[model samples]
Target: MNRILMLLFMCMPVMLWAQRLPVHEKQKELQERMVEVSLSEIQERLSLTEMQISQLRPVYKQYQKKVARLNMQNHKLFNRMNADTLSDEQAKTILREYLDRERKLYALNKQYMDNLLEILSPQQVIKLYQSDSDIKRKIRMEYLRRTGKPKR
Candidate 1:
């Protein structure tokens, strides 16, 4: 009985870790799909040449990675704010970190736009931004429709 109990204990971590693998894989796949869709939308909107698509792909991927990192950092900080016993100093520190992340995000956006402009005309860049907004709005509308909820 003791040996069986010991074996279960030894297997527990592996079992839990295995269970998490699929979730991580699905998240990664979803992220990749979103990127592909966004890239396709950009191509369609801008009528990008094959050469331009090749140039834009790497720059866009890098920007996405940087933005994802900042977003994850901000999410952690935001979670820390929900702690029941958070002191004022802790709250202030989180606020400062959050603001720093926001500044970094702003700078990253500027840098991304500059990179985009190098490969695209100003009007194309503007259309790219508009496409993003439209995609987001459509996603939100779909979510609301699926959830059977009215828009707030």
Candidate 2:
């Protein structure tokens, strides 16, 4: 009983990490696909000019990359906290960093959206916003179907 208990304790973190791997991969793929779809949909619906698309595309891509990086780091920190290896001070520092990145990304996205809106009509912006969620849901469902997992 003592040997079994010791083995279980030793393996617990590995088991937990294994479970998280699939979920993390799924989420990352979903997020990247959604961003791709969003940009295309916005371009199509707004009939964005070539110059506008060129300018806006890089802006979106840059911010998306930044958001993904920060989010991944945050997840790593959170997983450490979950494993009881992260100190309170470290967790607090990571949380603050995450929040700051989130706020900055939000502002950047908003600025890009505003620029696009200047190029697109109000109705087009509304349509783009509405379509975003629907597209993401569809992509997620399709992903789950392919992977044989229930949609989360």
Candidate 3:
């Protein structure tokens, strides 16, 4: 009984820490699920063969993950800037970093676009991009609705 109690005590902190994780982490998980749903919807719309589906999902999953990561970084940078007033020097530095991050994200997106071309036909690629844009727009709208945000 002592050993069991000791084990429980040792695990308690980890459990509490997990529960205390920032809302951002939970929001990230929710966003990831939305991405999955968006991707699956795209997949359903595509006329992919079995082999193509197998090849496409993983590459696209990476694309989705990288986009999400870059967006999170972009948001973090803006949030950090907003969290405090900054000197001209500090603001200029953060602006440069933001620009650099945007360039990196553009490059990442271009790389994935090229990668997708290697796996899919031009027509299919066009369809995929269109579907992704549509799904993301719908997801944004749904999120706004759920949060009771007024749409512009």
Candidate 4:
């Protein structure tokens, strides 16, 4: 009876959170939230001014959206992959598309770099990139800790 109560107490909040999953199925909102959090951290880390943030906002959002779309498309390509039955020509085509998207991402990132130059010191730009990965890592670590999951 004690063990049962302990288990129930431990799982109650998790169960409630699970029930809210559908309401939170807005992936775009989640993505935006993540970006906002990351941007806030970066802003704090680099001591960005109001004007700097105003300048960076639209460009950053565009970069995020483009990256998200590219990621989704790349994910779809792999989802359709079947190594056992894939023909050489099909493999070639997928590779070509992947490379093309990679080039696009490279150019897009370069554009973002150029845009940042207009509003941030080069050192601040580097810190902004670092803050992004740090925020993501912390979020992932918190999720793993809460779920009692091992690192993948």
Candidate 5:
């Protein structure tokens, strides 16, 4: 009995950590689900040819990855700038680089849209744009709900 009690006590932190593991897994699962759903909605609205779908899928994934990286970098810059340790020149340099990349990405997105349009009718392009916006809104709502807060 004494040994059992000691073992349980020693395992307490492990038990706590294990409990949190499921929650973390759930969060990751939800994020993946959102991305999949968003992509599906896009695909449905676009009604792409097999070849177009094959081409666009990778371009879309690359855009998502780039946006995520930019978001992280921007967040880090914001935190550092707010902390007052970063010099004005450093802040300006970071902001300028971010803006440059953002413009480039925007152009790339436009090019992708043009490529998609070439494969689709104008009506289909409009539908795709509308569906993309709807997906973004849904994802925002889900994020707000997950955080237990309303969007500003």
Candidate 6:
């Protein structure tokens, strides 16, 4: 009885952790797939050489990870703002954090562009940016269409 209860307590955390492992792995796999798709689009739009693609892959992956982290932070801040009992100071703090994340995102974009310039022509870099925006817009439109939501 007592020993069985103790064993169950000991195994509970391990069981919970094992359950979480697949979810974490799935998230990682999705992120990798998104990065691959983005890279392929950029490569095709820029008409990148093999050498250029090799150079861009690492820089782009790091950029994507940092951007994802900052965006997650911003999403958390937005969720915090939705709390019904939020106070003025709390609201101000969340606003500041949100703006800080935005600035960091901008800095990340600038650094990514600087790195791209080293491997690509200015025109190619410009087209890459435009193509990225178009891709995002298309994704958003598709989401809206599937959800039957009107454009804001």
lDDT of all predictions: 0.88, 0.76, 0.85, 0.89, 0.76, 0.88
- Tens-place lDDT per residue, model 1, 88-127, is 8987888898898999999999999999999999998898
Encode model 3's per-residue lDDT on 7-125: one tens digit a residue: 99999999888887876698879877886787678778987777877788789888888887888888988885563678888888888988998999999988988988988988989
The residue pairs in collision within model 2 are none
* Model 6 C-alpha lDDT per residue in residues 51-90, reported as the tens digit of each score: 9999999998998899989988888778655656789888
lDDT of model 4 at position 86: 82
> How much lDDT does candidate 1 score?
0.88
The C-alpha RMSD in Å for every predicted model, in order, reads 2.8, 6.5, 6.1, 9.4, 6.1, 3.9
RMSD of 6: 3.9
Which regions of candidate 4 fall more than 4 Å away from where they truly are?
A: 1-25
Rank ordering of all candidates by TM-score, starting from the highest: 1, 4, 3, 6, 5, 2
Per-model TM values vs. the true structure: 0.81, 0.60, 0.77, 0.79, 0.65, 0.76
Candidate achieving higher TM-score, 2 or 6:
6
> Which segments of model 2 are wrong by more than 4 Å?
1-38, 45-56
Cα deviation in Å at residue 141, candidate 5?
Answer: 0.8
Q: Candidate 4, residues 44-149: lDDT per residue as tens digits?
A: 8889999999888888889989998998899999897786688999899898999999999999999999999999999988888888788989999988999999
**Residue 133 in model 2: lDDT:** 62
